[model samples]
Target: MTEPMFWMSVAGVVLAYAGYPAYLVLRRSLDPWPVVPRAWTPPVDVLLVVHNAGDALEAKVANLQRLDYPAQRLTVHVVCDGCTDATAAVARRLASGRVRATVFAERRGKSACIGDLLPTLTGDVVLFVDVRQTLAPHALRALTAALADPSVGAASGELVIRDPTGFAAGVDAYWRYEKAIRRLESATGSMVGATGALYAARRQLIGPVPPGLILDDMWIPLSVADAGYRIVAVDDAIAVDHAPPDPAAEERRKRRTLSGNYQLLHRLPRLALPGAHPLSLRLWGHKWSRLLVPWLLATALASSALLAAAGSRLYLTLFLLQAGAYALAILGRRSAWLAGRFPPARVAAAFLSLNASAALALGDYLRNPRAHLWQTTRYQESGR
Candidate 1:
């Protein structure tokens, strides 16, 4: 029983990180389901929900105005969510024939703002974007092109974070790894979640997002999948955002995102049930299993430690490896020397940080119901 428990614990951790991606690779190679994107430019509603992003709006709006799509077919809607800053004024000042602005007096979360604004958008496709990131000139066109495939109901653009250093480098490494997984997931079938920084969905396929939802990106894509549509990844559609300047800022952002994973399941329990969701298995393997990894790590450590105490050489070696990795992670957190010198250490440290955040996420969610009202993480604006 003890040996079985130890093996199971190790297997769970391995399967979540290594095994799942391997399965995805094999699945794509054997019975591949590819997205057939074509040249299609439907009417697009470019939506921006800003809180206190007034300083960035001018550049963002200018960037939108430069998109390689038909000006007549593209409209930009900027919703100001109770901005105490100059956000409302800037938005109103930017209003033009193709750009419109709306202001809400109350400080509703982004999800709530999106919900209120979604119904009013009348376009073939709605592209959701953040103010901080600058999209490629052809981003909207690339995103809409994926919607040319009948099975694809939503398309998520890739986010490129530039010039990362220190622990930000580790976070950046993790982001690249995550993007590869999403790309694979898209090629095989649907993405478990979409990139919130830049993603577009068919207007008819999406419904109003629930208020106070932290992960509207996840909710939106999963909802489209529930309606029997594929959520694709558009590699050519890029939104460039700079890496957070501070390691703590990156950790906070990660914690909030991890917390949202819990909130997602609570809000949409049907997604976990096989009978209710078509992509339940994928969701479990990709998202839910990851949530359990911290606990699995804890279990593996405890079980192996116990077995090692009983003089088992195999368990002792496993325990040493785990301990050394964590020690390196701790060292990596304090100083960037090891990770800067060793790329693998950078990723490992980042992976450990993520799992730690996932473990803490539940506490954050339970203690603060208003955790959805996010404080924006600071990052420099990236060009092109």
Candidate 2:
């Protein structure tokens, strides 16, 4: 029983991390669905969502104004979601013919805020963005061009992290791996999700996201897929962001993101079943499988330990390798120097940290699905 459990767990881990991506690569090679992006300019609404981003609003608005797309075609909407700081005032001060500013008096989660603003959006394509990341001048152009393809419902921009070190370096590596998967998925079919920092969707396909929901990026793209359109990856569309200053900040971000995955699963149960969602297999491989990886790792480790106790040489070797990897992860966490010097250690630590975040996010999802609704108000005040 233990042997079967050990092998099953190992297979699951491989299937989640390696096997799925390999399948995508082969699929893309066999039957590639290419997006035909051209120099097409449509009216675009740049939706800049913020929560207590007073200091950053002005610069962000300036960044939007500087985009390579025609100023006349691009209209910037800065929505401040129940900001307690001078974010509202800054947005108002920056308001111009091209830049529109709206503020919510009460704190609402990002998804609710975006959903409420959907009806008011004025553009052929709605570009969603966060305050912190700056778009490359051509990013908007690239996304809009992809939208020019009638079959493509949405276009996701690639996120580029600048000057990462420590665990952030590992995060950067992971992001690259993730983007590769998205590219392959786009080539074969619609990707399961979009990069939340920067993505564009056709207004016609855009629908209201559930209130108090997290992972609007995933929801919007998947919803578009449900409407029989593809979400294409625009590698040229680049959104630039900085790594979190510290591990704690990264952890918080990861926890919130992983919890959003759970929220997505709960809201869209059809995605998990065969013949329900068009991209069900892709979602299972890319999104759902990773959610179970943490437990799979534990099962593999525990079973390996039990087999090793029974004097099995193969299981003993496997157990020692797993234990060594985790020990290195601990060392990487305790010593930033080691992680910085050794790339594998950094990756190991980041992998462990992410799995831990997944476990914690499960708790968060179970404890209070709406815990994030007022989270912005509380945490922003606390300087998170």
The global C-alpha lDDT for each of the candidates, from Candidate 1 onward, is 0.88, 0.87
- Tell me the spans in candidate 1 whose CA falls farther than 4 Å from its real position: 381-384
Which ten residues in a row are the worst by lDDT in model 2? 375-384
Over 81-161, each residue of candidate 2 has an lDDT whose tens digit, in order, gives 888889899999999999999889988788888888889877899999977787899999999989999899999999998
C-alpha lDDT of residue 340 in model 2: 89
- The positional error of residue 74 in candidate 2, measured at the CA in angstroms, is 1.1
Q: What is the lDDT of candidate 2?
A: 0.87
Which stretches in model 2 have alpha-carbon errors above 4 Å? Answer: 374-384
**Best model number under lDDT:** 1
lDDT tens readout by residue for model 1, 1-384? 778887897899889888889999999999899888889988899889888888888999999999999999999999998888888999999999999999998988889998998889899999999888988999998998899999999999999987787777899988888898999999999898899989999999996688999998988888899899999999999998887766677788888998998888888788788778878888888889999889989988998999999999999999999999998887787677776777767777888889999999999989888887877555765311
